[model samples]
Target: MSEAYTGGCACGAIRYEKAGAPIAALHCQCRQCQQRSGTGHASYVVLDRRDDLIVRGELQTWPVAGDSGNVKHNAFCPICGSSVFVTFEAMPEMIAIHVGSLDDPSCFHPGMVTYAARAQQWDRVGPGLKSFAEMPPG
Candidate 1:
């Protein structure tokens, strides 16, 4: 077991803890991610076990229609409007947390880049990382 991970919204209205380490960490450059993050991409860490997550405080979610036609619930703090975590209709067993929401974000090391096809040339991810134009095949 890895060290516990903890973080919350910018205003501290929402808090979360994951009992174990992340299974995967990556940056997504999909259109929806860019729009939601108001940037070129969104960084996320996936926790395979939903039970390891403990979220305290109310979260407001807006369902996003993915390019694949799957629905992803973008969870955020309603008060401070901070994007936090997300749940996907395509993968119900996992939770994707926004790496920016981490108390110590420097601890995150993204190993993959997704949706490279939509990435902006000005916002290119660093080289040598595993990358895919879209979600990798299962």
Candidate 2:
């Protein structure tokens, strides 16, 4: 990686850093993600390992049942209510950082869309990309 990815919540209360290249980056249009983001979709950059992720200050987390039937944990700054990160109950080690929370949003390159079935017909992700009704098999 050229420069290490570093970012924090909108309030700067929670900060994190990641080493190594990202495992996968995607735009999720699932119903659960839409509800969480209050937008058309949620953009996420997934890193398989959680070793280098560092959190500073306090981050409030909420575990929500996802449409995929997985327990999803969402993190944000208690002060700003900014959605920061997400983790899965089954795969506790992986970190899914919100693209909006990144200081450099350019670092995110979404390659696919998840939960395509639930995506609104008018609100589409893009023209071309892999689309899955649910998370593709690992």
Best by lDDT: 1
**How high is the lDDT of residue 133 in model 1?**
94
TM-score, predicted candidate 2 vs. hidden true structure: 0.92
lDDT of 1 by residue, 52-92 (tens): 68899999999978888899999999999999999988888
Clashes of each: 0, 0
- Model 2: worst 10 consecutive residues (lDDT sum): 1-10
List the global CA lDDT of all models.
Answer: 0.89, 0.83
Clashing pairs in 1: none
Instruction: Name the top TM-score candidate.
Output: 1
Model 1's alpha-carbon lDDT is 0.89
